[model samples]
Target: MPVHRRPPLPGVQRLARALALTAAATGVIHLGVAPAAATPADPPDRADVKAQVDQLYDEAEQASEKYNAAQEQQKRLQREAGILLTQVAAGQDDLNRLRADLGAVVAAQYRAQGLDPTLRLMLDNDPASYLAGARSLGQATARQNETLRDLRERQRRLDQRRQETAAKLDELEQARHRLAAAKDEVRTRLARARQLLGDLTAAERDRLAYDDDARAARGADRFDLGNEPPASDRAAAALNAAVSKIGSSYVYGSTGPSTFDCSGLMYWAWRQAGVTLPRTSQGQASAGRRVSLAEARPGDLVIFFKDRHHVGMYAGGGVVVHAPHPGARVRYESVSAMPVNSVVRV
Candidate 1:
């Protein structure tokens, strides 16, 4: 049948297209080929990033202190071992001399055919002379016995020294391993911190740095250090030394004219004052007499954190000069900015 149908209207064509799109979507759903739903996610904000970065920096500082402690211990062990080695060498020389003396005495006796002194005296033509010679021989024998005893004692001491040196070497090796491990940990933590910071936008990183500086500045401005005398001349010298390094970079495990860590700053500053503070914050914590924070004076060590892994020099008033952390320079901040562990007057 030749039937001519009218062409569909534009509205009908639009409706037909809509229907086709709906059928296709239905078919996709029925075939389990619909797009997956997007799960909700809350991205980390700037504050969250800052907190994480700070935590990582703190951990890195802790590991850096451990590395410092291990290095110091290794140095001490090496020094002690060297002293022991010197002593052992000297002892060995003495022992050898003693043995030589003993050997000479034995050879003299062997040449005499191991004869009894009284028998030898009886066989000699000049009995009186023989008696005198016998007495001298007896004295020599007594001296040899004493030398033997001395040799035994010296040998014992040399052995002890060797044992001590061996122990020190073992400890030195352990310290080296610990130093390596701490160094690895510090690197790991710092890398993590860098990665976290890297994830942020450049503007966010700038804002973070700006905020940190602003906070430090505000703290410094708020604390007015009155004109108070230092606890001692050494204290004043140390404070001045620390102040001289105000903008030095905070390099982990560095103690110096250029860069420093938390405890490193204290160590170097005190050294400038003719005092040697301990190399680690924990060690420095007990390096001097403890005092109340109220009695804390310039150059006094202000230990922070429950672990005592951080330290700073009191810069009068409530401010402290310290190498704060990685990526920060040595600067002044309020002592109350961190949890105070104790105050040490070194």
Candidate 2:
């Protein structure tokens, strides 16, 4: 049996040299087996699983924010609908009383046995005065007609109020359904993530946690604040406010002085600067003047990912202050830490 050596192709020669350099950089190699044609190594199972879990978590977080927004909307609509229902009930009562009074008036008129009620009243009081003052008879007739017209108008208004209340109730119901769906979606994604993590070994789980911690630590702001000037006074103030919120825990649907989501953090920070931001990151993406990353000021809002679901306020020097996600706290990170969709100056 003869062992034949195959000559390396031009491409293979360069690849072999590159691999040799890489092995040299690492300073470790098999003594006898020359770095032969490099073979692709199997991807690490832990890393692959970790990536899957991360993706699931990211999707869940997105859904969670939407659920929070829907919940807020549902609550607001419910309150409005309740108030409308109360008003409708009150109006219905008023209409019922008015109709009952009108019915009584009609019943009294019917019992009068075809007599002209106004004439009867005049006759009952003073025939001489009734004859001398024809104006009194005319006034009595006008008042009777006006009472019927008023009652009819009030009934129509009450009916309209009922219709409006019904419409608002329908809106409230729709909002409730949306909130429910959003919540379910978040739950489903999180459940799948939990299951995936359960399949991993304890060591793999620890690695995942370490990876997250490493990512957060590596994401520290590398920008010098003094190098980049804010585009506006409000932008500067908003950026400062956002920076002040560093370390506040992230909470879904929260836009506050204590905790916040990505967009919530931006919303609260901008609000502090007298600028109102929208509730969701997608909405905030459109709430300002679009600018290039180069033109972004310290207070500018930076939206990330193609769907624009995440947001952070620029903290100057290529860094941002944002609520990264669930289980994370507000912090300053590199603006380019995530795929940037756009920069907005509010």
Candidate 3:
């Protein structure tokens, strides 16, 4: 009971106490200190947001045209590959038959070997049979050689077709990817526009819509709708048909009696008039006679923008009926709304 442990060194005890206090102070600093305030970014104004949305929409249209072109190319490649595959299958069947025929000839020749000519003649019931066998021996040898050559050639052709098919398959996959990417871009841009609208008050949204409608109405009233008729009966019919679908919805890749895109509307309207237009605006742009805007008549295709991604049917006067874009119905608008690239008469 009298023996006690020696006390720690005074300096060591002081250092230990000091460390504990330092740690406690550090903990207090950590727990009490607030995080630094983050810098807040300014929200985009309505005009800036609208401008971005419009630019995105334009870019999306360009991408969509590229996607459509890729789709057309993919379809062509698929059809060509199908034809090549069919040809290759037929060639394979021919090659197989030729091989079987050559094998039969070899078997017959083997059976004929080591037999006397007189005995060979006696083995056959008819003299014609013996003569035919003799003739076949010579002909089969030549035919077998020819058949082998043909087989080799056919095989080579088949191989080439298979390679082409593989290449086409690869291209088709690439086209599909591109189409998906274009669709995504369009969807993303539209979604962002919607979000921007959501951020605005209901009154602001209504005002924006009202402004757009008023602007369009004012522009429509100012357009000089000439009393001149279409260039031809078909052109007149096409104009009437396009005008009838004034309220139809815009749908990408649709060439229909109902929903339509810019080029699809042209295609459908022209088809109604017994004229056939190409599947895309770019293709249709070059399908007919080029005409100046001064010479543009009703039913003439009014291609727009320097890229020529949009198309509309010229209505009488200075107006054009078109499926403007997604979320917009087919309607009459001034051609001056977009840069006039060219006019074409189909």
Evaluated with TM-score, which candidate comes out highest?
Answer: 1
RMSD of 1: 15.3
User: For model 3, which pairs clash?
Assistant: 225-317, 226-317
TM-score for each of the candidates: 0.82, 0.73, 0.78
Better of 1 and 2 by TM-score: 1
Please provide, for model 1 over 221-329, each residue's C-alpha lDDT reduced to its tens digit, 9 standing for 90 to 100: 6678777888999999999999888777889999988989989999999999899888999999999999999998888999998889899999988889899888777
lDDT (Cα atoms) of all candidates against the true structure: 0.83, 0.74, 0.75
Model 1 TM: 0.82
Candidate 1: stretches off by over 4 Å: 1-44, 114-123, 212-222
lDDT of 3 by residue, 1-346 (tens): 0001222322354456667766777776799975444446444455555554455555556665666677777788788778877877887888788788878877877887768878878886897978887887788789778988887888898788788778877877887787788777767766776777777677777876675555334434666778988978999999999888877776666787888877888889999999888878899899799999999999899888777898888987888888777655677887777788899988
Worst 10 residues of 1 by lDDT: 1-10
Q: How far is candidate 3 from the true structure (C-alpha RMSD, Å)?
A: 17.5
Q: Which number leads on lDDT? A: 1
| Candidate 1 global CA lDDT score | 0.83
Give the C-alpha lDDT of model 2: 0.74
**Where is model 3 poorest over a 10-residue stretch in terms of lDDT?**
1-10
